[model samples]
Target: MKITHYLYNAFLIESGDKKLAVDPGGLMFYYFRFSPLIPKSEWNNVTHIFVTHGDPDHYWHADRMAAVSKAPVICNKTMVQEIDGKYLLLGPRDKGVAFTTEFKNHHKLSVDETIEVDGVTITGIKTTHGPLTVKLGPFSKTLNPGRDERIGWGAIGFKIQLDGKTLVNLGDTLLHKDEWESIDSPDVLMIPIGGNAVHNTMDIPEALQAIRIMKPKLVIPCHYNCPAFFSKNFNHADEDEFRNELEAMDIQYAILHKGDSIHV
Candidate 1:
């Protein structure tokens, strides 16, 4: 199988004619910062679209991709809810999304749920979204970080089994209690390593700790290099540090530039 990186957490996985894309982001918060990496011709045949969470950077063009491929959007139940504004219980805004789509081929899953697509099996893994924000000062002049709460409602990771190899993609999340221990070692793991006071994703130290626990054969980092204008808190740490740490620990890893491919 071959994997192609498409900036942020977006990835294109291909084995033979079966193509699966994860998180293909859309324009930057209605701006035009991010454009498509894979041509429409390629994404049109994607057999499955997987979304780890509902951030625009993670799920902007998914509905259209599903429409083109006629494949199911396999994701955690929270993602499915966001697709339809099910209960309007998403994000900091209690308000519901303006419009929604039916996505006739949607697949709503939960932690520990498993689904098979074509010949590949996808297992849902538990993941905690970044910390919630607490309003501070008048008119929300400041922000305070809340406790590390496992996003009980709206986030997830995936253990994908394709062509006898496993790939784990943990969307935007922080280190969770014992959650990393539950995932079996995969051939490759995609994790987040861009975090700080303004953000809730993992920093380098936490990522190294996760690797020590999961012990995957290879590791790839994601959820970084976002434009500051998109979200002030949107941040990224240096991958050089992560690369150096992996080398010191004797772990194999790859830092893919956009459109780069790797095989296992």
Candidate 2:
């Protein structure tokens, strides 16, 4: 299997003649004015689209990708509503057109539920978004917890099995031990280490602990390094500490830059 990172969490996975796109959203910090990290033409052959959450940066451009590839979108219950959907509407738009999300077929899965397309198996692993924190200039406050997946776009992870390889993408979320217990050891684990004061996803230490528990063969970190102009709580720290720990434990890993691809 081949993996390509396209900024943020957008990843393109190629296996044989099939291609799968995960979290195909924008580089939101750039005000959504620039081109996608991965070009539209590259996505023309996508066979499946998986959205981890409904944030603009996550699913903002899923419709576009789906339209180009004519692929089936697999997402949470909120996106599977199947009714006419409303969206932030990426790219230039005409006034009063009522931008909405529509797909020929949407495969919705709840936590722990698994679906198979062709020969690949896709499972909706448990996940949670960060707490709702209201930031006030130099000060910040936490309003509510983020464990509400019942609300639909609450967030979720995915375990993709193809060609005897297993890869898990733990969207934007904290370490949920209970849910993690359900996930078997994966060949590649994509976790978010960009923990913030508001406690969105696991931080360096927390992510390390998760690594110890899940025990994946290859670990690729995500959810960090939001451009200063694009965020307030994001930490742009280097991965030396993370690497040192992983190296100490002799865990296989790779640090992927935008547009970089690796075989697993």
Candidate 3:
């Protein structure tokens, strides 16, 4: 199996006849310029798409990619609403908390629920996206996750089993030790470690705690040192320090830059 990183939490996992796109989002805050993380060239070949939440950095281009590739999207059940016999997805580009977007092929699962789609098995895992605090100049605003807010709407992780291997991707979430105790010894784990500064996802220390619980073979840290607003490294982290600690713990890890890939 081959895994490719496209910055933030966007990734492409390829094995046999399946190509899975995880969180195929766009670069947020660059309104004048549009930049897609997964790249337009790779859209047509995507077999499936997975979304962890409805944040713009993780879901901006999901509908477009799903439309182009004709791939089924798997997300938390809260992201969709069945109204008038039509399942409407939370609008990827809607103003706020509106289910205006609809995908022809989609699957919604609650936490701890499992589903099989096109020969792949997927299980939804519990997660919580922390409150996001945005700052501009002298003003700051914090958005908390709630029924009416969009900070971390539909936040959930994924445990994907395919080609005789288990891969876990925890999209921007805080540490949920009790909820994630059941996930044991995955082949690969993609976790976020940039929340120390922004208080959104798990920080490096929290991510290490999760690694000890899950005991994955290979760990890939994400959502750190990303571009946002006017800063090139909005969610900053010291990956080298993280690597040293992992080494002391005898855990294998990969620090992937944008467009980097690792084979397992």
Best candidate per lDDT, number?
3
Output the better candidate (2/3) by lDDT: 3
Best by TM-score: 3
Per-residue CA lDDT of model 2 for 1-264, tens digit only, reads: 899987667889999988989888766546335346567878899999888876656776788788888888887664443234433332212112222545665677888889897677998888877764535489766644333432215377899999889999988887787668766679999988877554667788888888888899999987676532246335454588888889998998888877788998
How does residue 201 of candidate 3 score in lDDT?
93
lDDT measured at residue 144 in model 3 versus the true structure, 0 to 100: 92
lDDT tens string, model 3, 67-182?
99999999999999988888999998776899988899999998999999999999999999999888988999999999899778999999999999999999999999998899
What ranking emerges by lDDT with the best candidate at the front?
Answer: 3, 2, 1
Q: After superposition, how far is residue 112 of candidate 1 from its true place, in Å?
A: 1.1
Stretches of candidate 2 off by over 4 Å are 31-34, 82-99, 132-154, 228-235
CA-lDDT, candidates in order? 0.71, 0.72, 0.93
TM-score of each: 0.82, 0.84, 0.98
How much does each candidate deviate from the true structure in C-alpha RMSD? 4.8, 4.4, 0.9
Candidate 1 runs further than 4 Å off: 30-34, 81-99, 131-153, 228-234
Candidate 3 accuracy as lDDT? 0.93
The true-structure Cα RMSD of candidate 1 reads 4.8
- True lDDT of residue 12, candidate 1: 91
Prediction 1 TM-score vs. true: 0.82
Estimate the lDDT of model 1. 0.71
Candidate 1: residue 139 Cα off by (Å) = 11
